[model samples]
Target: MLLISAAPAAAQDTGLNGMSRDQWLPTTVASDAPLPDDATLDTDDCRYDAELPSAFDADALRTSETAAVITVERPGPGGEGMDTCGTVAADGVDLPERLSLGSYVLYDVDSGEVLAAKDPYGLYRPASVIKILLVMIALDDLDMDELVPVTAEMANVDGSKVGVGPDGKYTARQLLQGLVMNSGNDAALALAGALGGTDTTVDRMQELANSLGAVATTVTTVNGLDTPDVQTTAYDLAQIYRAAFQREDVRTLLSTETATFPGYGEYPEFQIASDNGMLYDYPGALGGKTGFTDNARHTFAAAAQRDGRTLGVVMLNSTIAAGRLWSQAESVLDAGFDATSDTSVGTLTGGSTGEDAGPDAASAASAAPTESSLSSSTTPLVIAGLGVVTVLLAGAWRLSRRRS
Candidate 1:
């Protein structure tokens, strides 16, 4: 839903495509003592067992919270998008490099166990993939049958469009389908209007981000367009994606290859093919979202099930300089599926130690109201009054298209 706590960006450290060495890893909070700045934190004695290095340690993270492996050293200089995933593992199993450029994560959706990651908590601009979050909030708040009148402003919105003219109107269900299947900004606009304007919509989205423990995510636009403050992390994306996939309706939306969207006014109904390629190309691809911007490059979050294991992956600041963004994810998933889910680098929900998550006491979950108390003080009026549902959401890749 938004970005903050500016990262250190030095010239030599900036990436070929704009990623920088600073990596957006926040280091401290008000209360706890700063953890020792070390390249790797050994988790052999923690709740999960894995050896991965996060450039920085957070005071807010408990020992178990640190179990979520955030980064690994880049094996070598990988171009903006060169096949950073590399080749077969030592055992000849196809998997991603221990260190790949940019930020990406692979995890078991059912258990929220992180399998593999590179900069999993590195905050970066999310772009269009944020709509997946918007839908999660929308599904719970908006009445599916409610018709939202379109506006010329919506049709004229910059970026991608599902072509809804001022004279055309759509049910919340229809607009959501367009938003997911086509990565339509116009649909997001109309939906935002239905939700009571962008400001209110984003506030709700942020609240949802808080509930799901996506602390790094900050929603600036309901449509997931590029904005200076938009941000999210690979780790948080997995959390949001897992929550969204829990709903059967969302599973269908993510998997649907194409759908008929109503045309407004003089426009005729049109077919909107899914902008995400993984659904068609990857065997177990259930559904996911894609995003892009010159700054964001390529950001993706999707889920697939193999051998009954439902796994989700989130990649940020990815690019064609490597390979098709989807293929990069495939390599990550390939490595993930081959690994045992029993042991994790970290978890999606709370710490495995069954204790507090540490110093960052201001996480949205604590800063904001959750499903357990929608009627409480911090809950949004629209959401609270509905006595509604809950969702976790995420996505993006720009196909002349595409946030929370």
Candidate 2:
């Protein structure tokens, strides 16, 4: 369990620890340590029986169909008593009750604290959330205003699209807006081509992931289309998004609710609206990404600020409900904001041994909201099955339309 330090006398007396305004923040966890018994660090479905030979095997990941099932060592242990991964201390913030999610992490951007988490290191499909990485790499290498010619290959992508035609010409900025605001796979392909081909773009994304110490992440597709080998952990997702959030352009593009794409050549003018629901509903929502695939399920990454503190949340393999992701993210952020000054949870560790352990490992242990309490509830399972079915049916409908 995370440790909660009692507020100062004035705060205790007034029942208001003005943590929102105070500049003196607690020290972030700096080393690997065992987490409290209640922390949700492991799950039967996501753990590996033995440590991996390497943090990541890019060659194996690219060639193997069963590679997604292989789990790598994460910073923290699975739960209270497990010692496979070291433990860390954390304030016992109650997770939302009965929230059905596969893996999640909640992180404080400013304090570098993991407020709460569940299977934070577990690998799951990132879906469109992977586009965050694509956008990051693009911003680093490509000019935002440079016009990219939409090729036939880009226009033919199967998932969410912004309708850029084969002959369409769009600026990198417009394509980015489409990629993020509209969750456009076509935009992703276009951007990838602009940075070279899909192969080169994915290579750069993998390099970026490795450099960030996101060793568990493997990129098989630039747009996060459900590929057999593509996978990423919630911890990695948080890290990727945090890095992207630091850039003014990426932040602006993500927070944008609407954009107008002027028709170029053969492409017709069209207006696109953001698919991320949190921007409209959650106050202080900076930006977020949402994704789904037949295999990836529902994935969401979002951040919000309150009382001068900003928090980021990542949910992977979540259930499909109209607003569940937003509500869950809001709940986590609310709990983080409500935490007292003395709330010290276990630190997220860098898995590197000896001297190789750098700030990345210590600061990278991601967090996510867990069930405040566990109970034998059959309803969530049923709902999850239904959600999968809905997704499959939606995919079938899309396939049918394409065939027609």
Candidate 3:
């Protein structure tokens, strides 16, 4: 019996042994960076660590090398304040310890082993990487060939746009391409409309998040624009990407270098190339999403295959102050690949980390996504054939023992 529980909106825990609730979910931290236009939103206040230690040299690694002081807006490599304070690392593995990143998680996608991480659970605004989730549902439920007309509302969405307007009709696939290739808020809005409006779309996104074991994420926007309540962790992002990348279609769409998007109204058809720099600059790049908002700073999710191994990296609350987002991501990826030791800080777990919805919480989470396009891991958690068996689970998700 595949007995799963209902996941609530709140996260279960951040995995840190000691800290105040506000440290993980601070309500009063003000932004040192300028807010987006006139919008009101939550800020991390440049708080990168939760009293944790990093893998890099504590003495040599400073946010700035020569400057007397570094600010969050322009934090330098090994910036003092920007360290994630994460302690997770592969035993005796060397890392690109100089990269300036707030928090990141590097993991083996094929094996689900978290090779290394820095403040992996640090919470920050998920800028556009949330689009990966939006497209996941669109790809699952909406027909790619279906034609969707652009609305002016979609065209006028506040952030980045892939140029959808009222005058043109686009296939679902085209809108999705714009969403992925251009980080188009317009495409996101259009796709949400096609999937039964913003409310339904956000609901489905949250459901998928809960189903994916992404306890640290809470969805509030179709595009990853920051809202006070909208947030995610690097760890949760890795989980999100793991589930999303399993779809062969999502992989092909993200890997696309350039795609032609139809122009609506007065705009002419234009080409939208992959905005993620890693796709062009890094070898074995599997393609991923990039996002930025004044508050979010920078967030990235991408993976690559090298030496017969596939690895994914998720960087959150990052800034160009240290190194470029992709550059830091590349460095972390390299560090993860450098580990010859089998030691892992943590391993990705099956989804369904929540209170018992009815019963059988363990049984429900044991089963991975069953979609034909989605592949399940053969990782010990046996994938039972379709059947109807009622399982009585004894432990709740929080009470159950699980890998990080």
Supply candidate 2's per-residue lDDT for 162. Answer: 76
Tens digit per residue, CA lDDT, model 1, 1-404? 11211233332354332334343232222233433332222222321112212212221122552324333233311212211332212222246433223667677778776666665555566777778868766665666667888888887887767678788768777787778777788889889888889898888777767666675577778877655455676666777777776655566666766555778667888656667778756888888887765456567888888998898888775543335567667877877788743555556662211111212323422332223322122122332343322111112233332211
> Clashes in candidate 2: how many?
28
The TM-score of predicted model 1 comes to: 0.65
List the candidate 1 regions with Cα displacement exceeding 4 Å. Answer: 1-94, 97-101, 350-404
TM-score of each: 0.65, 0.68, 0.68
Question: Residue 226 deviation, candidate 3, in Å?
Answer: 1.4
Model 3 lDDT per residue over 213-316, tens place = 77667788898865545667777788778776655567767776655578766778865566676765688888899887645656789998889888998887
lDDT of 2 at 56: 17
Q: Which digits, one per residue and each the tens of the lDDT, describe model 2 over residues 11-73?
A: 322112222211111111212432122112235444422321111112222334456454655
lDDT order of candidates, top first: 3, 2, 1
The true-versus-predicted C-alpha distance at residue 319 of model 1, in Å, is 0.6
